[model samples]
Target: MEKVHFTEEKATMLATLYGRALDSREADPVLGDHAADEAVRQIDYDFAKLGITRDSAVSVVLRAKPIDEWAADYLRQHPDALVLHLGCGMDTRFQRLAPPETVHWYDVDYPEVVELREKLYAPAPNHTNIGTSVTDFGWLDQVPSDRPALIVAEGLTMYLTPEDGTELIRRLVAKFPSGELICDVFSKLGIKAQKLNTPVRRAKATLRWGIDDPHELERYGLDLMSSLDASHWSTPDVMARLRPFTRFQLRMLKYFPALARMANIVRYRF
Candidate 1:
């Protein structure tokens, strides 16, 4: 295997077999992505480079399926809306959403990720891949200010300082008239605990923002929408369909969203 540089979440999600597992979601709704093929390749590259097996990644991704479904649902509501995937990495969301030809999609990222995306996954007619730092505003100018936007940042916030996260929201809201943003957050305490964990600490990746109060995002621009816990996916009917072990976790997830917060999904709108 070739030595490679793998981004943390990218490797983690891939290890979790995001798309294959997604295929198993009978009622889960998100447009599926064709680029999922390439994302798998990228994840394999990273896993080999990082010297870790794929097991842990599977656990994390399976635990976070609700977040993926949420992103897909947002795009369905605003099909013509501009879609920006910040710090996009290898996520195949645009290919999955496959927005209407009328919609404009921008995948913003560091040069390397963008290059990889371009080399591995071809963009659809409606899609545009921007190889630039999300902190830079170059791609925003490409979007029409008249239309609203749906911005999705899966695991990018943790890499940015709190001020940068706020500024990104501020600029995104200012540039797009009205829009929805869906992202995840760590509490400051959670961030610290992650730092102290030897394996994660060795990765040298920084965890930037933790929200004791997720509501603080409103100060930047977004309005809080409904908060979600895994229970949002469950019911007595679904419970009847699950295996004994699967049902056990969903039951735990319902009353125990906190346990699910080793990773989290938060939704917002501006």
Candidate 2:
């Protein structure tokens, strides 16, 4: 078994990884992320201590499904695209998508997280893992700027200060010839209410940036293509697969716009 030494913000990744594993074990799984299940089993850590619930696990998959679909769609359009998966927390999206060999995939995170990934996942033909904080500009130098890039930053933006997050978006948009940026964002209200979230609070991770308006990002050179609130992120068919309480919560998002828009999956094209 691989021993883990993650804590604080890093430990938050484990909680998400375990949540995906939990979803994979369900009778009618949302993500069916068997690779995550396999990774959880291989790690020598007590995931039970994280206090993640079944409903929350399903919620995790709900947020992830759209991002997965968007990434897959991008790959279909640009088979030779460059994928910059920022703050990738042991997600098997690259494996799940199985993009064409021409696609160059980069999985980036903190050095230790990347090292942990090296142990858990096998190397693929056109994949590379860069071990550095995503905010550190130097890592961008290693990636070629010649292709249509797809930058996916799931459950990542909220952790960055507004300056860092905005600058990151600007740098990414300016670097690629042209492509898309897909990321999930929490509203300012959501950031204030984050302490109520168990796994995040347990990990002692803090959220810094909260985007109330996605259009503001357009000023950085991106044009908003889609901004899906929590309730709309998943398709009707996928929504039907969720548990009752989870369904109720999503339904409430319609009645209460503020609650519904507490979080969103936004897509932008430069």
Candidate 3:
């Protein structure tokens, strides 16, 4: 087994990876991520210590499904697009999407995370792993700007300070001529509540950026297209697979817009 020593924010990725693995083991799996399950089994770490439950595991997949569909849709339009999965932890999205060979995909993350990924996953055609901090602009030079870029930043924004996060988005927008960006963001209130989050608290990671308004990204040369509340992250099929209590909580989000908007998945075109 591969032993891990990730701490703070880096350690949090393991919790999410384990969450997906747990969901894959469910009777009615949300992600059905066998790869994640396999990766979890291969890694020597204390997953239970992260306190991820069945509901939270399902929540992880729910946040990812729509983003997967969006990425696939973008690929359909631009088969030769440059796909950038920023801060990609142990996510099997590249495997899940299975984009055409015409597309170039890059999984950008810390060097240590990429090293772990290399050990676990097989290399895919037209895919590259760049091991560097996403905030470091030097890595961007390695990515070709000729093609339209599809940027997917999930569970990553809040970890960055406003200056770093905003600059990252701006730099990405400036890199490509056209494409869409998909990301999930917590509201200011959600940032305040981060301490209460079990996995985050356990990992000892601090969340800094919270986007209360999706339109705020427009300054970075992105046009706001659409946004989905945590409520819309699920469908009937997904909800049916979840436990009753979790189902009830999700349903209640529709009645409380404030609570629902506390976390959202937003899409933007540049």
Candidate 4:
């Protein structure tokens, strides 16, 4: 297969997947994503340029674990629900979750990303691939509104402007009668810190939006269920197996509330 050429923002998606794949290769893996590992092997790219290290791999995979858990729970509750994975990238979440056949899965992203995804993934009978930016509300019409929906936006909100991100949430809440949204957001401080984030800087991607308070989503008519500091709540079990110095640094970060607030995993219901 020919190598995929993605833009800066789109390239970051591949970087995260590679990180997860690297983590999965460890003796005791946190997010055991064998599919990601396979994709990394099949795809031709220079991973070293992405600045992904063993330490960063743990952090990236840990961020994705919460979304997987939340989506899995929602699918169990609403077996026949519609799952909309915004900014899906090349993530194999649907494969990992393995929701019931009754669930309809839609992976939405930029055309280039979706095209590459088609090469790497085969959708189930109930699944569809949508090539469009999340900001475009046109694609929403294609999705059925009768069934409850579960929307997941991982590592996506930061790239959008506040206006665009909030509008996307508002549209989703308004479209689905009873549904849940699980997404991660950066704080204002976190947006500033992105400049120093090696992976993000390496990808030449800019972080444009952030939310310091979970209640901020309420402004857009979304019912904020919970917003958790990822550094504290989403630490993967495998983290304990890391070097003592690494574990100590992560533990220290947990005690610093200001620093901890940098990234959060939030859940909202409509």
Candidate 5:
């Protein structure tokens, strides 16, 4: 393995991968991603440079879990759906979910990241890797539009300008006859606070978009189905199981409306 020279935006994928790998190693993991753990072992990068800690990794996994759950549910209903994983990075969601053979899965990302993924992971019969930016609509043409679809954009929206993100969603909704999208959004405060986010700063990436209300997406002609505050410390069951100090810190965020609104997981249907 050699040092990967990914651009700042592409490098952010390493942070998420590191987070998933960290969570996978926990005794009682929040979102165990053994594939991520394996990928981490295979990649030759300085994990320390990402500044990922146990606590931060937990946050990352927690935010991802809800989206995974939603996708799982969608797949159950439409096992043959097309799954478009935008900004796929080195994520192993397809391996984790293992949808039916009838399903077609496409992992879309920058060419370099896709190239790295091809080297790191084995190919699946129904899985296609699209080497292109998610903001580029041309990649969407490579996917079939005549089936139910599940589009996932994890840890990705904030990197796109609001107009670009909205346009992407609008295009997807209009392209497919019926489909669902699961993605995360940052609040105005969260975007501002990214300046202090260790992994983000280390990656030299800046947050570009935020939304106060999930309904704001309706402006793009999407039907906002639901949204959940996905802060790692916000879930009652997860919080109750944490150490007292951790619980206390999370409780403070939960009780404070402004802070609690920082991050959210939203689902939209077309």
Candidate 6:
């Protein structure tokens, strides 16, 4: 028998919300700031039908939190920076970043996800949506080079080989003279284990990346900023409610960066 997991774009959103719901539960005020006022609860309901559990949901939600938190803080450092979200899927990061009218925002992804996003979210004057694969270099020419930029790639990396991931970013950083980029990278272990463990997912889109050291990307042209732990972002109280095994894993991640490498973020300079 095979267990069910979310489809690609849907899984990405579920993952982003999972961390967010946990943050929301922990009373992180920033959590509220990142949520789309017009879309929060409705997005929650849409995910409910997927049958993913609360804990599973929280894990995914945290994916955006670290970077979302970073984006919020990033604004304080550079208010007018442009933000480019790769494989933007259906997630609402522009609303999360709440960029000023002065900030330029771009949401990009496959034509399919962008199509679905249009049904739910319409771009404001400052926000733009482009339907394109990250592998394509066309979108880079569209964003202005005159201002600093921050880029995020959520659940899209796991579908690409490490080589392609590095090249895509190499070009992005090269295309934009100054910018910070953050993304979640899944390892070969997680993909192999998840697919073998859940047969239903293996038949769908594949999980392609599992590189542990996102810093390795420097050779490809991106400057390393930070490596974030997927589990460490959780507060103590949230950790307590997790299953004993999850609690143990959290503890391990806190003390051990290598373990954290299993699921982590690599921030880089352009």
lDDT of each: 0.63, 0.89, 0.90, 0.87, 0.87, 0.67
| Candidate 3 wrongly placed segments (more than 4 Å) | none
Give lDDT: candidate 2, residue 217: 88
* Reference-based lDDT, residue 248, model 3: 96
lDDT, candidate 3, 1-270, per-residue tens: 999999888998998999899989988777788999999999999899998987777778888888888889899999989999998999999998989999999999999999999999999889999999999889999999989999998899999999999999889998998999999999998899998888999999999998899898899899988899887877797788778988999999999988888789888999
lDDT of 5 by residue, 16-85 (tens): 9999998898887877799999999988889878888776776788888888899999999998899999
RMSD for each of the candidates: 4.6, 1.5, 1.2, 1.4, 1.7, 4.7
The alpha-carbon deviation from the true structure for residue 10 of candidate 3, after best TM-score superposition, in angstroms, is 0.7
Best by lDDT: 3
lDDT score for residue 29 of model 3? 79
Give me the runs in candidate 4 sitting further than 4 Å from their true place: 234-237
Over the full model, what C-alpha lDDT does candidate 1 score relative to the true structure? 0.63
Q: Which ten residues in a row have the lowest lDDT in candidate 5?
A: 230-239
Question: By how many angstroms RMSD does model 4 differ from the true structure?
Answer: 1.4
Model 5: residue 148 alpha-carbon error in angstroms: 0.9
If both were scored by lDDT, which would come out higher, candidate 4 or candidate 6?
4
Cα lDDT tens digits for candidate 2, 1-270: 999989877888899999999989988888899999999999999998888877678768888888999999989999989999999988888988888899999999999999999998999989999999999999999999999999999889999999999899889988999999999999998899988878889888898888888898899999999999877755576567668877777778888878767798999999
- Candidate 4 clashes: the total is 0
Q: Per-residue lDDT of 1-270 in model 1, one digit per residue for the tens?
A: 223365554343333334333433435323234345445544435333332232222233442455567766876787778888887776766655556787788888877667767776765888888877777766567667888788888667877887777888888889877888887766666687775533345455567677756787888878888555434544465456456776787678657656545445678888
TM-score of 3: 0.96
Alpha-carbon shift of residue 141 in model 2 (angstroms): 0.6
Tell me the TM-score of each prediction against the true structure. 0.75, 0.96, 0.96, 0.96, 0.95, 0.80
Per-residue lDDT, model 6, residue 161, is: 74
lDDT-wise, the better of 1 and 4 is 4
